[model samples]
Target: RRKAGWVKERLDWFEQMSQLAVDREYVSGETFLYLGRQYRLKIVYGSKRSPVKLRGKFFEVNLSQSMPEQDRREAVRRAMWRWYRAHAWEKIRKIVEHYSARLGIEPPEFRIKYQAKRWGSCSQGSVLNINLRIIMAPLSQIEYVVAHELCHLKYKDHSAAFWDLLRLVMPNYEVRKENLRRSGWQYLL
Candidate 1:
Protein backbone atom coordinates (compact mmCIF):
# COMPACT_ATOMS: atom_id res chain seq x y z
CA ARG A 1 0.00 0.00 0.00
CA ARG A 2 1.75 3.20 1.17
CA LYS A 3 5.26 1.68 0.93
CA ALA A 4 4.51 0.21 -2.50
CA GLY A 5 3.29 3.59 -3.78
CA TRP A 6 6.42 5.36 -2.52
CA VAL A 7 8.70 2.79 -4.13
CA LYS A 8 6.94 3.12 -7.45
CA GLU A 9 7.20 6.93 -7.41
CA ARG A 10 10.92 6.84 -6.59
CA LEU A 11 11.62 4.32 -9.35
CA ASP A 12 9.79 6.50 -11.87
CA TRP A 13 11.96 9.49 -11.03
CA PHE A 14 15.16 7.44 -11.20
CA GLU A 15 14.21 6.11 -14.65
CA GLN A 16 13.62 9.66 -15.91
CA MET A 17 16.99 10.89 -14.65
CA SER A 18 18.87 7.89 -16.07
CA GLN A 19 17.81 8.88 -19.58
CA LEU A 20 19.96 12.01 -19.29
CA ALA A 21 23.07 10.18 -18.08
CA VAL A 22 25.90 10.95 -20.51
CA ASP A 23 27.87 7.69 -20.27
CA ARG A 24 24.86 5.50 -21.01
CA GLU A 25 25.57 5.22 -24.74
CA TYR A 26 28.36 5.50 -27.30
CA VAL A 27 26.39 5.99 -30.45
CA SER A 28 28.06 7.60 -33.43
CA GLY A 29 27.02 11.12 -34.49
CA GLU A 30 26.65 12.33 -30.92
CA THR A 31 28.00 15.82 -30.29
CA PHE A 32 30.58 16.90 -27.68
CA LEU A 33 31.70 20.25 -26.40
CA TYR A 34 35.21 21.77 -26.29
CA LEU A 35 35.88 25.35 -25.24
CA GLY A 36 32.20 26.32 -25.51
CA ARG A 37 31.91 24.97 -29.07
CA GLN A 38 29.95 21.87 -30.09
CA TYR A 39 31.65 19.27 -32.28
CA ARG A 40 29.67 16.61 -34.11
CA LEU A 41 31.11 13.13 -33.45
CA LYS A 42 31.92 10.51 -36.05
CA ILE A 43 33.25 7.10 -35.08
CA VAL A 44 34.92 4.97 -37.74
CA TYR A 45 37.03 1.82 -37.58
CA GLY A 46 40.66 2.48 -38.37
CA SER A 47 44.15 0.97 -37.82
CA LYS A 48 45.92 2.64 -34.87
CA ARG A 49 47.53 5.91 -33.67
CA SER A 50 44.96 8.63 -32.91
CA PRO A 51 41.72 7.43 -31.36
CA VAL A 52 40.08 10.84 -31.17
CA LYS A 53 40.90 14.15 -32.77
CA LEU A 54 39.01 17.25 -33.81
CA ARG A 55 38.97 18.26 -37.44
CA GLY A 56 37.32 21.60 -37.97
CA LYS A 57 34.07 21.27 -35.98
CA PHE A 58 33.82 17.46 -35.99
CA PHE A 59 35.07 15.16 -33.23
CA GLU A 60 36.40 12.24 -35.28
CA VAL A 61 37.05 8.97 -33.46
CA ASN A 62 39.13 6.33 -35.20
CA LEU A 63 38.58 3.06 -33.43
CA SER A 64 41.15 0.27 -33.78
CA GLN A 65 39.69 -2.58 -35.81
CA SER A 66 41.10 -5.19 -33.41
CA MET A 67 39.14 -3.89 -30.41
CA PRO A 68 35.69 -5.16 -29.51
CA GLU A 69 32.69 -2.81 -29.64
CA GLN A 70 32.69 -2.28 -25.88
CA ASP A 71 36.44 -1.70 -25.94
CA ARG A 72 36.00 0.77 -28.73
CA ARG A 73 33.53 2.71 -26.62
CA GLU A 74 35.91 2.67 -23.69
CA ALA A 75 38.74 3.85 -25.88
CA VAL A 76 36.64 6.74 -27.08
CA ARG A 77 35.82 7.66 -23.50
CA ARG A 78 39.46 7.45 -22.44
CA ALA A 79 40.64 9.41 -25.46
CA MET A 80 38.24 12.25 -24.78
CA TRP A 81 39.40 12.39 -21.18
CA ARG A 82 43.04 12.52 -22.17
CA TRP A 83 42.33 15.34 -24.55
CA TYR A 84 40.36 17.31 -21.99
CA ARG A 85 42.86 16.79 -19.22
CA ALA A 86 45.77 17.93 -21.37
CA HIS A 87 44.02 21.10 -22.44
CA ALA A 88 42.72 21.81 -18.97
CA TRP A 89 46.08 21.37 -17.31
CA GLU A 90 47.86 23.67 -19.74
CA LYS A 91 45.33 26.50 -19.59
CA ILE A 92 44.28 26.33 -15.95
CA ARG A 93 47.88 26.19 -14.73
CA LYS A 94 48.65 29.43 -16.50
CA ILE A 95 45.53 31.11 -15.18
CA VAL A 96 46.34 30.10 -11.61
CA GLU A 97 49.86 31.44 -11.90
CA HIS A 98 48.64 34.69 -13.44
CA TYR A 99 46.12 35.37 -10.70
CA SER A 100 48.35 34.28 -7.85
CA ALA A 101 51.19 36.51 -8.99
CA ARG A 102 48.95 39.56 -9.33
CA LEU A 103 47.47 39.11 -5.87
CA GLY A 104 50.90 38.41 -4.32
CA ILE A 105 49.50 35.06 -3.29
CA GLU A 106 51.49 31.87 -3.67
CA PRO A 107 49.85 29.45 -6.11
CA PRO A 108 47.90 26.90 -4.14
CA GLU A 109 48.53 23.24 -4.78
CA PHE A 110 46.22 22.63 -7.72
CA ARG A 111 44.80 19.58 -9.45
CA ILE A 112 41.82 18.52 -11.54
CA LYS A 113 38.96 16.70 -9.88
CA TYR A 114 35.62 15.62 -11.30
CA GLN A 115 32.69 17.09 -9.41
CA ALA A 116 28.93 17.33 -9.91
CA LYS A 117 28.02 20.86 -8.85
CA ARG A 118 31.24 22.81 -8.34
CA TRP A 119 33.57 24.14 -11.03
CA GLY A 120 36.33 24.86 -8.52
CA SER A 121 37.02 24.50 -4.80
CA CYS A 122 39.74 25.52 -2.35
CA SER A 123 40.31 23.33 0.67
CA GLN A 124 41.70 24.43 4.05
CA GLY A 125 45.25 23.32 3.15
CA SER A 126 45.23 25.77 0.23
CA VAL A 127 44.61 22.99 -2.24
CA LEU A 128 42.76 24.22 -5.32
CA ASN A 129 40.81 21.74 -7.38
CA ILE A 130 39.37 22.57 -10.77
CA ASN A 131 36.72 20.45 -12.42
CA LEU A 132 38.11 18.92 -15.62
CA ARG A 133 34.74 19.32 -17.34
CA ILE A 134 35.24 23.07 -17.03
CA ILE A 135 37.70 22.97 -19.94
CA MET A 136 34.73 22.34 -22.20
CA ALA A 137 33.41 25.79 -21.31
CA PRO A 138 34.59 29.09 -22.75
CA LEU A 139 38.09 30.21 -21.76
CA SER A 140 36.78 33.34 -20.08
CA GLN A 141 34.53 31.22 -17.91
CA ILE A 142 37.44 28.93 -17.10
CA GLU A 143 39.53 31.91 -16.06
CA TYR A 144 36.66 33.15 -13.88
CA VAL A 145 36.67 29.87 -11.98
CA VAL A 146 40.46 29.94 -11.62
CA ALA A 147 40.36 33.44 -10.20
CA HIS A 148 37.64 32.41 -7.79
CA GLU A 149 39.47 29.46 -6.25
CA LEU A 150 42.75 31.34 -6.16
CA CYS A 151 41.00 34.12 -4.30
CA HIS A 152 39.89 31.50 -1.81
CA LEU A 153 43.53 30.92 -0.94
CA LYS A 154 43.63 34.49 0.33
CA TYR A 155 40.13 34.78 1.78
CA LYS A 156 38.65 31.41 2.60
CA ASP A 157 35.04 32.59 2.55
CA HIS A 158 32.86 34.40 0.04
CA SER A 159 33.44 37.68 1.83
CA ALA A 160 33.89 41.26 0.64
CA ALA A 161 37.67 40.93 0.46
CA PHE A 162 37.23 37.87 -1.74
CA TRP A 163 34.73 39.58 -4.01
CA ASP A 164 36.90 42.68 -4.34
CA LEU A 165 39.99 40.61 -5.23
CA LEU A 166 38.10 38.55 -7.79
CA ARG A 167 36.60 41.69 -9.31
CA LEU A 168 40.03 43.22 -9.65
CA VAL A 169 41.36 40.13 -11.38
CA MET A 170 38.42 39.56 -13.69
CA PRO A 171 36.29 42.57 -14.52
CA ASN A 172 33.92 40.44 -16.61
CA TYR A 173 33.80 37.62 -14.08
CA GLU A 174 30.13 38.18 -13.20
CA VAL A 175 29.11 37.48 -16.78
CA ARG A 176 31.37 34.44 -17.05
CA LYS A 177 30.14 33.04 -13.73
CA GLU A 178 26.51 33.43 -14.80
CA ASN A 179 27.21 31.77 -18.12
CA LEU A 180 29.00 28.83 -16.48
CA ARG A 181 26.12 28.34 -14.00
CA ARG A 182 23.40 28.65 -16.64
CA SER A 183 24.93 26.27 -19.20
CA GLY A 184 27.40 24.05 -17.27
CA TRP A 185 25.03 21.06 -17.36
CA GLN A 186 25.67 20.58 -21.09
CA TYR A 187 29.39 20.09 -20.42
CA LEU A 188 28.87 17.36 -17.80
CA LEU A 189 28.80 14.78 -20.53
Candidate 2:
Protein backbone atom coordinates (compact mmCIF):
# COMPACT_ATOMS: atom_id res chain seq x y z
CA ARG A 1 0.00 0.00 0.00
CA ARG A 2 2.81 2.41 0.83
CA LYS A 3 4.55 1.66 -2.45
CA ALA A 4 1.33 2.28 -4.42
CA GLY A 5 0.82 5.55 -2.60
CA TRP A 6 4.39 6.67 -3.39
CA VAL A 7 3.92 5.88 -7.08
CA LYS A 8 0.69 7.86 -7.19
CA GLU A 9 2.40 10.85 -5.58
CA ARG A 10 5.27 10.72 -8.01
CA LEU A 11 2.91 10.56 -10.98
CA ASP A 12 0.93 13.52 -9.67
CA TRP A 13 4.10 15.58 -9.32
CA PHE A 14 5.16 14.76 -12.87
CA GLU A 15 1.75 15.71 -14.23
CA GLN A 16 1.93 19.07 -12.48
CA MET A 17 5.39 19.85 -13.79
CA SER A 18 4.47 18.78 -17.33
CA GLN A 19 1.35 20.89 -17.28
CA LEU A 20 3.29 23.97 -16.26
CA ALA A 21 5.92 23.37 -18.94
CA VAL A 22 3.53 22.89 -21.91
CA ASP A 23 0.67 25.27 -21.07
CA ARG A 24 2.72 28.43 -21.56
CA GLU A 25 1.43 30.67 -24.38
CA TYR A 26 2.55 34.01 -25.80
CA VAL A 27 -0.78 35.84 -25.70
CA SER A 28 -0.91 39.49 -24.71
CA GLY A 29 -1.69 40.25 -21.07
CA GLU A 30 -0.41 36.80 -20.16
CA THR A 31 1.84 37.19 -17.15
CA PHE A 32 5.51 36.13 -16.90
CA LEU A 33 7.88 36.14 -13.98
CA TYR A 34 11.35 37.65 -13.47
CA LEU A 35 13.31 38.28 -10.28
CA GLY A 36 10.35 36.93 -8.30
CA ARG A 37 8.02 39.52 -9.78
CA GLN A 38 5.23 39.02 -12.31
CA TYR A 39 5.21 40.99 -15.53
CA ARG A 40 2.45 40.96 -18.13
CA LEU A 41 3.29 40.18 -21.74
CA LYS A 42 2.21 42.75 -24.32
CA ILE A 43 2.25 41.75 -27.98
CA VAL A 44 2.92 44.70 -30.23
CA TYR A 45 2.85 44.45 -33.98
CA GLY A 46 5.67 46.41 -35.58
CA SER A 47 9.14 45.87 -37.03
CA LYS A 48 12.23 46.17 -34.87
CA ARG A 49 15.68 44.67 -34.66
CA SER A 50 14.99 43.21 -31.27
CA PRO A 51 11.80 41.26 -30.77
CA VAL A 52 11.29 41.66 -27.06
CA LYS A 53 11.95 44.27 -24.40
CA LEU A 54 10.72 44.80 -20.87
CA ARG A 55 9.17 48.21 -20.37
CA GLY A 56 7.80 49.14 -16.98
CA LYS A 57 5.56 46.27 -15.85
CA PHE A 58 5.12 44.56 -19.20
CA PHE A 59 7.29 42.59 -21.57
CA GLU A 60 6.72 44.15 -24.98
CA VAL A 61 7.05 41.68 -27.85
CA ASN A 62 7.37 43.54 -31.12
CA LEU A 63 6.57 41.51 -34.19
CA SER A 64 5.49 42.02 -37.81
CA GLN A 65 1.82 42.91 -37.82
CA SER A 66 0.96 40.60 -40.70
CA MET A 67 2.65 37.57 -39.19
CA PRO A 68 0.26 34.68 -38.53
CA GLU A 69 -0.72 33.98 -34.91
CA GLN A 70 1.02 30.60 -34.87
CA ASP A 71 4.25 32.09 -36.15
CA ARG A 72 3.95 35.04 -33.84
CA ARG A 73 3.66 32.71 -30.88
CA GLU A 74 6.88 30.98 -31.80
CA ALA A 75 8.57 34.31 -32.38
CA VAL A 76 7.52 35.51 -28.98
CA ARG A 77 8.87 32.36 -27.36
CA ARG A 78 12.22 32.77 -29.07
CA ALA A 79 12.38 36.45 -28.24
CA MET A 80 11.60 35.77 -24.60
CA TRP A 81 14.36 33.20 -24.40
CA ARG A 82 16.81 35.63 -25.90
CA TRP A 83 15.89 38.35 -23.45
CA TYR A 84 16.01 36.03 -20.46
CA ARG A 85 19.35 34.57 -21.43
CA ALA A 86 20.97 37.96 -21.87
CA HIS A 87 19.65 39.28 -18.59
CA ALA A 88 20.46 36.10 -16.73
CA TRP A 89 24.02 36.20 -17.88
CA GLU A 90 24.42 39.79 -16.81
CA LYS A 91 22.83 39.34 -13.39
CA ILE A 92 24.42 36.00 -12.55
CA ARG A 93 27.87 37.23 -13.45
CA LYS A 94 27.62 40.17 -11.12
CA ILE A 95 26.29 38.02 -8.32
CA VAL A 96 29.05 35.51 -8.80
CA GLU A 97 31.62 38.25 -8.63
CA HIS A 98 30.17 39.63 -5.42
CA TYR A 99 30.10 36.23 -3.71
CA SER A 100 33.48 35.15 -5.02
CA ALA A 101 35.10 38.23 -3.56
CA ARG A 102 33.47 37.54 -0.22
CA LEU A 103 34.65 33.97 -0.39
CA GLY A 104 38.16 35.29 -1.16
CA ILE A 105 38.56 33.24 -4.31
CA GLU A 106 38.86 34.21 -7.94
CA PRO A 107 35.54 33.80 -9.65
CA PRO A 108 35.31 30.43 -11.37
CA GLU A 109 34.26 30.05 -14.97
CA PHE A 110 30.50 29.71 -15.40
CA ARG A 111 27.83 28.97 -17.97
CA ILE A 112 24.15 29.77 -18.05
CA LYS A 113 22.03 27.20 -19.83
CA TYR A 114 18.96 25.05 -19.53
CA GLN A 115 19.10 22.22 -17.01
CA ALA A 116 15.95 20.15 -16.57
CA LYS A 117 16.60 19.23 -12.95
CA ARG A 118 19.35 21.38 -11.40
CA TRP A 119 19.38 25.03 -10.40
CA GLY A 120 23.18 25.15 -10.37
CA SER A 121 26.17 22.84 -10.23
CA CYS A 122 29.92 23.03 -9.74
CA SER A 123 32.18 20.64 -11.60
CA GLN A 124 35.38 19.03 -10.38
CA GLY A 125 37.25 21.50 -12.57
CA SER A 126 35.47 24.34 -10.67
CA VAL A 127 33.30 25.47 -13.54
CA LEU A 128 29.87 26.63 -12.47
CA ASN A 129 26.82 25.57 -14.48
CA ILE A 130 23.88 27.76 -13.58
CA ASN A 131 20.45 27.12 -15.03
CA LEU A 132 19.06 30.02 -17.04
CA ARG A 133 15.62 29.54 -15.54
CA ILE A 134 17.05 30.82 -12.25
CA ILE A 135 16.64 34.33 -13.65
CA MET A 136 12.93 34.02 -12.90
CA ALA A 137 13.61 33.49 -9.22
CA PRO A 138 14.13 36.20 -6.61
CA LEU A 139 17.55 37.73 -6.24
CA SER A 140 17.96 36.13 -2.84
CA GLN A 141 17.25 32.66 -4.17
CA ILE A 142 19.63 33.28 -7.03
CA GLU A 143 22.29 34.25 -4.54
CA TYR A 144 21.69 31.14 -2.50
CA VAL A 145 22.08 28.88 -5.52
CA VAL A 146 25.25 30.62 -6.62
CA ALA A 147 26.70 30.52 -3.15
CA HIS A 148 25.83 26.85 -2.77
CA GLU A 149 27.67 26.03 -5.98
CA LEU A 150 30.60 28.24 -5.10
CA CYS A 151 30.95 26.44 -1.79
CA HIS A 152 31.49 23.30 -3.80
CA LEU A 153 34.73 24.87 -4.94
CA LYS A 154 36.06 24.67 -1.40
CA TYR A 155 34.43 21.39 -0.48
CA LYS A 156 33.51 19.15 -3.34
CA ASP A 157 30.81 17.29 -1.48
CA HIS A 158 27.82 18.41 0.58
CA SER A 159 29.47 17.41 3.80
CA ALA A 160 29.11 19.39 7.00
CA ALA A 161 32.17 21.45 6.06
CA PHE A 162 30.62 22.43 2.74
CA TRP A 163 27.34 23.48 4.33
CA ASP A 164 29.25 25.39 6.97
CA LEU A 165 31.03 27.37 4.30
CA LEU A 166 27.71 28.13 2.59
CA ARG A 167 26.19 29.29 5.86
CA LEU A 168 29.14 31.52 6.60
CA VAL A 169 28.79 33.17 3.22
CA MET A 170 25.00 33.33 3.29
CA PRO A 171 23.45 33.34 6.72
CA ASN A 172 19.84 33.24 5.54
CA TYR A 173 20.39 30.70 2.78
CA GLU A 174 18.01 28.23 4.35
CA VAL A 175 15.04 30.53 3.91
CA ARG A 176 15.94 31.24 0.31
CA LYS A 177 16.39 27.53 -0.35
CA GLU A 178 12.99 26.81 1.17
CA ASN A 179 11.35 29.48 -0.96
CA LEU A 180 12.84 28.01 -4.09
CA ARG A 181 11.76 24.52 -3.10
CA ARG A 182 8.17 25.60 -2.44
CA SER A 183 7.59 27.77 -5.54
CA GLY A 184 10.25 26.84 -8.06
CA TRP A 185 7.76 25.27 -10.47
CA GLN A 186 6.23 28.66 -11.24
CA TYR A 187 9.61 29.89 -12.48
CA LEU A 188 9.53 27.62 -15.55
CA LEU A 189 9.03 29.43 -18.82
My TM-score estimates for the predictions, one after another, are 0.84, 0.89
| Residue 74 Cα positional deviation in candidate 1, in Å, after optimal superposition | 1.8
Give each model's clash number: 0, 0
Tell me the lDDT of candidate 1.
Answer: 0.82
The sequence of per-residue lDDT tens digits that candidate 1 reaches over residues 154-187 is: 8899998889988998888899988876667677
Clash pairs, candidate 2, are none
- Choose the strongest candidate by TM-score: 2
- RMSD (CA, Å), candidate 2 to true, equals 2.8
RMSD of 1: 6.2
Number of clashes found in candidate 1: 0
Q: What are the lDDT scores of the predictions, listed in order? A: 0.82, 0.90
The parts of candidate 1 lying over 4 Å away from their true place are 1-19, 22-24
The TM-score of candidate 2 is 0.89
